[model samples]
Target: MDVVRSKDGTRIAYERRGSGPVVILVGGGLDDGSENEPLAAELARHFTTYNYARRGRGESGDTAPYALQREIEDIDALIGEAGRSSRLFGASSGGALALEAAASGLAVDSVAVYEVPYMADDAMVRHWAEYVDQLTVLLADGRHADAVELFMRLAGSSEEDVSGARSSSFWPGLEVLAPTLAYDAACLGDGQPPVGRLARITQPVLVATGGGPDPHLEGLRPSFFDEAADTIAAALPNAERRTIDGETHVADPQSFAAVLEHFFTSSGDFRQVSL
Candidate 1:
């Protein structure tokens, strides 16, 4: 693992692999970089991939009073470490963070995101607001386990599965990462698509979704991911919308990596669909 010091002096840990154009993998909720290693390995075949533990997870050091910009600084540090502008692939809420980074005008060459977890309707927004409130309270009280379970339930975990997970040895590991859930929530403010902010990003973006239903979000709404993807694609000045057939919220890493490779290697002009 390699380390980079962010602007705020937080020590960010990441593993760099492969030998080509740089692509940084940003993992979403509860991810500690390990979850993204599979996708990173696949991308590494053609791109030099950096799989890093986000702040507050894995081997990365955390600072007090986390802000969304701090996470952006972390990405900037990684780009500096790569010694050039780099493309980014962010999963779930991490996707939102990547968009934010690009919008902030960092050294991002381009971006690709998978189901950024932004809600499409008032109902879903209200539901997410409740989750945010509950999460905040739980974390404030330091009820890490409850916070983790609450997040699991929000992600559409079955009661039985939640019970099993709570008893499993991995549950403790999850608890340690619970605090970052708030960080992801902050990335998707009010659970609405940040159209204005997204429009400001001039970099080429690939906004992707799965054609199949997302079981993790089934209880919330139908075609939620697709709707969010459409909104994002429309909002962006330069973007393309692609739906991966038979893939749900959890994408097939190999297939997703292929899509990314194609985009990253291209001239980044997706003229077919763009605002």
Candidate 2:
């Protein structure tokens, strides 16, 4: 893993692969670069892939008093390290970060985001804050599994499914990263009310959601995905929205790769081709 220091001196780690125009992939809560490893390998076929670990995960460093702006700076540091304008793909909370960075003028060639949870409604914002507080308490009690379950439940996951997944292979890692749940909550905030501050993004943007026709989890509403798409479409200067039919929050790599290829390869402004 290659390392770069962010503006606040936290070490950001990333792995570079393949050999073409650069495309940096950012993962969401509790996720390191490994979360997108499969997708990155697929993209590597056509672009130089930079699979980055957001601060505090993998080989990255974490300083006390973390701020959302520092996370944005981590991305900027990667773009600068790439030494050229690079395409960015962020998932969930990571998607929110990418949009924030682009709006802040990071010189990204293009941006692609999947299922970012943004809401403009005030009621939802208040509800989200309460939920965050609940999860924080769960984490404080060393109930990582319970915290994960609560988060999934808040995201609309059914109790049965959460229980079922608890014994699965994925749950352990998610529990391990449970404490960082606050980081994602901070990135998302109450209802993710428009950082009305983001209308400045001029780079071509692609906003996507899962079309699997199911809520993220049982009991949780699907408003997060809907509001996220609406927010990006309304705020970005040049943006397109797509729904990946039959896919959900946990998308298959092949489906994700195809969506990425269609957007990044066909977006003429970013990558020029020779016939």
Candidate 3:
């Protein structure tokens, strides 16, 4: 692992592999770079891939008074180490951060995101606010395990799944990184698609979603993800929407890598090619 110091002097750890054009993998909540390593390795076949632990997770360091800009700076630090420019692929809320980085005027060549976890309804907006409030209280009260459970359920974990996780050996490690859940919440401001903010992004973007049933949650509509991806794609000036069939909310790494390889390696034009 190599380390880069963010603007705040916090050490950020990353793993690099393969060669060609650079592509940085940004993972979502509960991810500490390990979750993205498989995808990175696959993409490494044709491109240089860097998978880094977001601040407060894995080998990365954290500073006091966390802010979303701090996380952006962390990505900036990684970009610097990557020779000051790179394409990005983000999963779930990490997709939100990647767009924020690109919109913030970072040197991003292109972007691809999978299931960025956004809602467009008033009820869901209230639900998201409640989640943020309860999560804050739980973390403040030192109920890290409960916070993790809450987060999992928010991500569509069933009762049985939550119980199984609680009994698993990994539960303790999850608790240790529970506070960073708030960082992800901050990344997903208002839990709705930020069309105004997203419109500023001029980089070519691939907004993708899965077309299969959510394996973890029964009765969940496939449109849940498609609509989110569509909303985001429409907001961006240079973007395309894609739906990968027979994949879940978290896509199979190989399938996703194939789509990304096509998009990232495209010849400047955001359209006309199949993915």
lDDT values of the candidates? 0.90, 0.80, 0.88
Better of 2 and 3 by TM-score: 3
lDDT of 3 by residue, 112-199 (tens): 9998988866776787899999999999999999999998887778888899999999999999989999999999998999899899
Candidate with better lDDT, 2 vs 3:
3
RMSD of 2: 3.9
Q: Write the per-residue lDDT of candidate 2 for residues 244-273, one digit (tens) a residue.
A: 778888678877887788788775543211
- TM-score result, candidate 2: 0.88
Better of 1 and 2 by lDDT: 1
**Where does the lowest 10-residue lDDT sum fall in candidate 1?**
266-275
The candidate scoring highest on TM-score is: 3
> For this target, which candidate reaches the highest lDDT against the unseen true structure?
1
TM-scores, all models, native as reference: 0.95, 0.88, 0.96
Off by over 4 Å in 3: 219-221, 268-275
In model 2, which range of ten residues has the least summed lDDT?
266-275
By lDDT, the better pick of 1 and 3 is 1
